[model samples]
Target: MKQTRISVLAVFLVLAMATAALAATEVRMVGDALVYGSFFSNRNFTGWNAPAWTSATPTWSKAGKKTEEAFEIWERFRLRTDFVANEAVKFRLEMKVEDTWGHGTFTAANPEVAIMIYGAYLQFKLPCTDVDVTAGLQNVALPQSKMFYGSPVFGDRMAALVVKAPLIDKTLSVMAGYGRLIDTNRTYDTTTTQVADELDAYFLALPITLDGFKATPWGAVAVAGKDANLFTLKSSQQNSSFYADNLTSAGTYATPKLWKNDQNAFWWAGGAFEVSALDPVKFYADVIYGAGAESDRKKSHRSGWFMDAGVEYTGWDVLTPKAYGWWSTGEDGSTANGSERMPMIRPNWGPGNSFLFDDSQELVKNSNMGMSPVGSWGLGVTLDDVSFVQKLTHRLTFLFVNGTNSARAIRTLNTLMGSNPYFQMGRDLTINEHVYGVNFDNKYMIYENLSAVVETGWAHGEFQQSVWGHSLVNQSRNGDTWKVSFGLSYKF
Candidate 1:
């Protein structure tokens, strides 16, 4: 009886091992974090000139001329797991966390902690077919030589259903995806959070190879619900100044601009090509055009046409050169039906390490994730991947920018910790301000997964905004602004 029991136990062990091997689970984790600080000269402080070139009230601030600087840090972490449940079924789940230091009440009794689901989806092959289907939250990036329409433009994840199938075997591929930008929700705090306020988008792409070159033509369309845009919607990051008008949210010091109840349609079609058919003398280009309209929702006639083109030549690793130009129709300040300036954001390819220094953020538009290149157009040239020493590489870029729609310049400037409104707007501004800038970027690889970088940027120009500080003719122009930053980052 004892020998029989031992044989049974061995059989059970063998079965357990076989099941484990068949499961074929794989897990991986990769993350990166950055800690950096910058010193700003003439960044937060201008020579005033608020009341124009005069003696008293000449500068905007009471302290006359000023300068400010500070340091900041941020991090990003990701985890991914994949497993084969069966012969023809596979699944993957990815999670991510990204935030700058001091996001919320860190010392509070219940600190706010947020972790986003970056990618959580299921994948499987169709029975008796060479097609694949993926459903759930996913990562989607459009084709681009630059970052023209690549990656999640606004946020991290796309809750979508996607399908991919080969049309001509390995020569041509087609893909389609549909997703919801904002889910229809009924919030506990607001009764007006209706289903009709949700936003949805769709994407279609065809990537094909001809000889040694590849081409990708893609199209996308997004629909915004009534009063569902960033300006109209009130969230932690944006407000319509409705409360500021009544001295509530951020008090009366906040800039006041009423949001229009809008239903907007945005669409774009573009193509990218990689001319690698010529080996070391390869060339690349990306061209795009997009039009947006809000119809009669706002009664202001909001519409715009935007375009961008770029070319690059990577003949050598140490001295690649690239250039690009963009144009977007501007607004005429006409109160006809709506705004005419483009409402969508352009991919901000900064003159430097965009994280450390960027004109689009410091000069025109800024967002929580970094900088936004929208409502503006310009040209730029860059020298990339200059490496003369081991483990060190350098890059430099020069740029010129002008507002596309309005005289879009910053009005109020304050210290890093100063209590002033971070961004204040002036109604009577021009799209005439132009900026010429240069950037220097140096990167040093310390280890296989670690790096250190230094970056500097300088911009010399100014915008004239005359509708602030209780004055109708108070025009201001800040002279020169520069930033220097150093950072350390680790990835695995």
Candidate 2:
């Protein structure tokens, strides 16, 4: 039924485009041609003998070898056309289709789809300086980080109306707009009956120039509608024993308390600055803060911030050496109790099983991934070889996460009411973990429009908990993973 609905929507969109094309006076089309392909090999080690230094046992891993190999292809096509061009108003239409095919751990057969208004709106350019007014489904502007407010998860698509003007002696431009959060390609289950309405207002100030330094300050507030239902909350009452069918039986009853109020709102603000301090050194830094609870049932308010500061130096005079370091923190604010503060999901473990579902520190069995109070700091040194063969880039990065073992959210879930074995299946399995890895990528242009690439990586870490519990005995293990891949691609 869901698939049928999606197909009907697609057909309706096509017909609408056709009708618009026939009625337009002036038309222009633009697009891009792209073909991308890659191959990969993956391997994971989990079980009693897994890494010992990271804390916890491997409930998801058994003493064995698990591997997967596959290839993938990516293609995208876009079309844009202008319908009306006049002195006071101009209108345009845009459409795009993207498809993918592949195998392996990173591969999926289901092609992702996105359909949007694109540029199907009107723009009124005024005579004063460079000012414009835009209405209808238009582009929403935010800060430097694409992850905030925008569709960073899949594709960028939000509904909004924007106004543009010049400021600061014409040295700065400002954009203010109102937008709403719409369901993306991935929608929740309709049976859930929970809907969320998010309305946001954003403002951006971009300085034209400041002594050769560029800076921008952006801010936004998202007001959730009163009817928004964040998450389902339930409580259970357990009875030790009851007489049933001539036998003693234990019964558990769960009750639901429906919460229908919109006391939750989120505020986000940040700025970024870039400057060239010396002949060989360039500095950049960005800071962002977000606060407010996503739901009221938990009576929990989430607040976190992130900072990215780095300096890059280029040695163009010699080997063209490059070195830089980055630091990032803060949560994504998707979980009720701030589950983003953990690294259990999609950890960079070199080509091995991430054991994402086997986290012992997570209270919830299945949860979204995000930054745990833990922050990652890493430094990399890269050397570019442009003299011969294709451009060769070699990079080495070292990262460390703080507060890895401090995830009380997962710990509390496991110990709920104490001695609940079902809830403890994979809880508190591992403690703080330290990961180190090396990645190498080589790209060579086989022809004018074709290229060949080779990449490989290796990582090793220790687990901090026992895989199996034995009387008076606790044990841990160490593990390592590696992967290699080669592929060819064509671009136009």
Q: Rate the local accuracy (lDDT) of all candidates.
A: 0.51, 0.39
* TM-score of model 1 vs. true structure: 0.69
Stretch of 10 with least lDDT, candidate 1: 243-252
TM-score of each: 0.69, 0.59
How well is each residue in 254-366 modelled by candidate 2, as lDDT tens digits?
11222234434556666866676574676666566655444544423444455555555655533344444334442231224442321110111111111121111111111
Model 2 weakest 10-residue run by lDDT: 241-250
Q: Which digits, one per residue and each the tens of the lDDT, describe model 1 over residues 377-433?
A: 778877777888999988787877676644322332222212122223221124765
RMSD of each: 11.2, 11.7
Candidate of highest lDDT? 1
lDDT of 1 at 140: 59
Query: For residue 428, what is the lDDT in candidate 1?
Result: 16
